[model samples]
Target: MSTNARLQANPRIDAIEQVCSKELLAQTAPHDTAPPGLSETRSDGPLSSADDVEQYGLSWETRAALEHSHCRLSLESQSGHSAHRTSMDRETSDTDGNTYPEGGLEAWLVVFGSWAGLFAALGLVNTIGTFQTYLETHQLKEYGYRSTGWIFGMYAFLTFFCGVQIGPIFDAKGPRFLVFAGSVLVVVQMITLGFCTQYWHFMLVIGVTGGLGASLIFTPAISAIGHFFNEKRGVATGIAATGGSVGGIIFPLILEKLFPLIGFSWATRVVGLICLILVLLACLLVKSRLPKKPASKENVLPDFRIFREPKFALTTAGIFFIEWGLFVPISYISSYALAHGVSSQFSYQILAVLNAGSFFGRWIPGYVADSLGHYNTLIATVALCLVCNACLWLPAGDSVPVLVVYCIIFGFASGSNISLAPVCISQLCKVENYGRYYATSYTIVSFGTLTGIPIAGEILSQCNGEYWGVVTFATCC
Candidate 1:
């Protein structure tokens, strides 16, 4: 049958056309004329008016679905470019038949929740340098750089790697229980950190507990934002991500000041108390917009078959390389500063400076990405990271001025590495399945996070504690 005949034969399509006849006509009204039979709708005949639409006895949800589909198809056909629809076209209703509020009180509340949760989880991730420096000088002083690196590496590893299961769980069950559980683990990790004096104690609390809690919080927080946005997804995610940078900035400074005044134990407890408040807000506010699907074998399992898509595979690889070296600076900048004869005070403060720059980097690039394109913006930032590492960091030696500049430039460039990766992943799959795809990609990228720090630490040891090799390593990554 012809296309028109087939459409007419489908009862659902025929009903949709009839119910949405007026709306369809109004949408296409800008044309010089309507379709052949639409002008005769004033008369008593089929597809005549809203009265005929009501005669089909369709539910409001069904009518709404058909109306959107028919109108969208009609417009695309009129433009004669349906095959080449732009990203802007996809913005309207990109996933299944669901509609987004885009912005409303409830939607923005979700963003706030994500921001608060990330502030607590990623704040700690970003402050790893401060933690490393302190532990190296005191708790783990007897351990070699290579041995100490594994503790932090394990923390970073579980942070992203655990997303393999968390992502699918978020897709099936939503964020409520996940966020609650993650919050409890994180609070416990921070509270217990003060009491850690042994290598195994640090490993169990900071590495295992911290990593698992962070994974649960951030994965769902980022995934939930995708449910409420498409066209604006980049910026919304960026805004939420800034919470981590903010936490990075404040937490480090707080620890630095409190370390001597209050000692390590109470300082960590204070930070834990702050985390308690932030995570409580997240638990109360962060929510999933998508309806929960049934927990089933097919839905809950991780699907590696998505690698069959060449674009997705390439994206994953790019993220892997980026992540491989991304944490090196966050893990070592303080140590690098102290080794170069910078004041101990300034060494700790430099991390705050980097995170300060990151605060702007997260949201600004996100806003620009919405217009210039997510991939375009990500490429530009990654290239900037390369320049900062090679030209500024590698050559700075003991120059504080140059090192400060490197910190700012590199921090800004790397900030998008976190915010944009999820948005990019969402582009490859429907928003509903975003958690699965995002989790799977990060699951692969997790190995990079696991290895990057230890590899840098080994390079540090191999070069007799020199940082040039590590800087060069980051530049190449």
Candidate 2:
């Protein structure tokens, strides 16, 4: 049999030849009119008989030509699909070649987890003002203002300082155990805090223990968010960091009401219970997306070598100055109010008011930072902090109206300080090494936290309890 005869004899080859011939004709017809023989083949739709195939000049070579067209079209279609897929992948990846879901159920869930953890840890950090005021007049009344300041100073000190070690461990391992251990220490601190009356007791429970716990929880909480977001990081971190402001708002009100109803010990225990619940939620939902690194000696320890970079060193120094005065207001605002004859009931509420403004501050600047640039927004906010103190808080003296306005404006501006600092640090490093960079910067900043409050207190003492001198000190920082 001839080639056409053999092809026609085989049912499968006959079908393929017909399909390919029709497809080839349809493709060519779009751009140009079909040729005479091919036109007859197109009109018939298929070469049904061997005579039709011969008449149309549809030989084996023509059949091979049709098959080639089909293969070429398929390859082009696949190439288009492959290009589209690659474009999508590139859109999802960051500059460091890290892929993120950007925003998904899992990613948002992690944000929520970090938020809850921060609520407990940072909440206490924010409430240092209330804690300091209460301790000054009550348990530690005999101690000078500068002396009592050290307790809270130590609390803030260890909280960020330990991140030097905790950050690297988080980069190596994960958040699970670190969060759990931190949660335990924080819960223990809150539970035992009310029972402690001595100077050393407060230092041990609130200062040392609470700071360590907060460090472990704080570093991991912020770092885990880096794994799931890059583009929306500012807003997401702001949302999480607001947990602290939220805690600052609620905890003081809770203590104010509960201190009268329940007494200090049980009121604190109640706070502990709340923290326990929040940290538990964090433990369940917060997780790391990166592959685990082998916990070698180098991986587990903090390497200070990163500071060799000039930009990082400068950022760290800027943060140091920011943190130096940052805690002065947080540690002294309530006490300042009480000393100036503001009702004790309203004094505690003052911290809440500041924190309430901070609640909005934490996230709003973050959203703007996404568009304006992190460093720009941060610099503006820091400048605003200086303005609020110099223009409002410093000159207000006993004016409640001016102080309230200062609290709100300063609170809003300072809110970004906490939320954006980590983001600014993240800009200097990769997503995976975020913990180390953040911890290192804050570790240096921790010294400022350690000294800022005490320095303010000493200034207060030097000026014979006049707050202008202390306020001026904060304004300078």
Candidate 3:
């Protein structure tokens, strides 16, 4: 029977068979030739039957023309064939293009693991202010704010820079080993932090060890979610990122009560206990989606050629400035308040308020970013941060309410800068290479984190105790 006649006699059957055949072809196709618009077709060209074309879901005229063509089926047919081949490609291109792997108990459990891991890693970064405030008064009290700033600055630096090697390592080896090692290092650092009484000790335990632990946990924790969801990525990432905000809030409260009650060492031990629990959960749950790539020299080192893209270059610059400015406020807010005659309790509470706002800040703006455009959302957030510094923080001086308001607003606004930064970086690169891109970008930007607090500290010193110089420097950077 003619193809059209066959299709007409049992249209439903023809459609089902056509779909099945397409799926079969897709399953058998080589990966390199599987992506839509990237495949090569036969020189003999396509099937000539109008009915067959229609069965394939193409218009009659187009199908007939494609069938008659000397060249391979039109670009559209190649695209359609490609879509038919890979379920992932088809799902990704659809209206609700977001798709996840088989969803059920195991998938969600992995997400839970990621959430726990992120909570521990990012949580500490979020709570840096609490650490900074406490250390400035207790452990590192004799050091200038700028000098002590190096401790947290180095922490931030290592948190990001370690990602350079960690990303490639994760891609090659998976999260199992990485998360395990990181957990051990982080727990060790926390346990030792209570014993640290010197500058180099703080740098060794908190800066290097804590930073490495964070990088190990965070990079995989965030990257693993991409293995599970595409359409739901924004929500998943936001949910995972909230761990940081939660940690931020909890740590400050714990420190506030413990500092006066149990003293600094015990307070740190308490925080470490919390971290141990969270990190353990992370180690159990977080996993890499793709099978690990074989270890090779190519996969081991970072590729700097990505800077050839101007948009990426601009993004790196923006993140650098943001990081450069971010830690200054985090490290100095309490000191700034105390120097300006704000009450000690209020000064400490200010950091908590900032973190409280950040909880929503990380989640809401992330959802918005999925809709409004990641770069657009990021640019707006960066501007808000700048305004918070320039308008609210710059003039507050000794005003308690104004400073408190600034803390809340700025905290919320800056929260996205921390959480969404990886999302923004993901937008710029492919999923398989996300870890590498993210790690490389942050490796360069970590320099900004390293220097920012110290520079701000120096500015504070140069001003002979005023924060205006630091504020101005923050705004300018």
Clashes of each: 0, 0, 3
Q: Quantify all predictions' global Cα lDDT against the true fold.
A: 0.88, 0.87, 0.77
Tell me the alpha-carbon RMSD of every candidate: 9.7, 7.9, 10.2
Query: Candidate 1 on 297-410: residue-level lDDT in tens?
Result: 887888899999999999999999999999999999999999999999999999999998888889999999999999999999999999999999998889999999999999
- Best candidate (score: lDDT): 1
Candidate 2 clashes: the total is 0
lDDT of 3 by residue, 309-345 (tens): 8877888888998899988887788778888898887
How far out, in Å, is residue 442 in model 3? 0.6
Give the per-residue Cα lDDT of candidate 1 at 395.
87
> TM-scores for all candidates?
0.82, 0.84, 0.79
Model 1 alpha-carbon drift over 4 Å, by segment? 1-91
Angstrom error at residue 451, model 3: 0.5
* Between candidates 2 and 3, the TM-score winner: 2
What clash pairs does model 3 have?
26-85, 98-231, 146-457
Global CA lDDT of candidate 2, please?
A: 0.87
Question: Candidate 2: minimum summed lDDT over ten consecutive residues — where?
Answer: 70-79
| Highest TM-score model number | 2
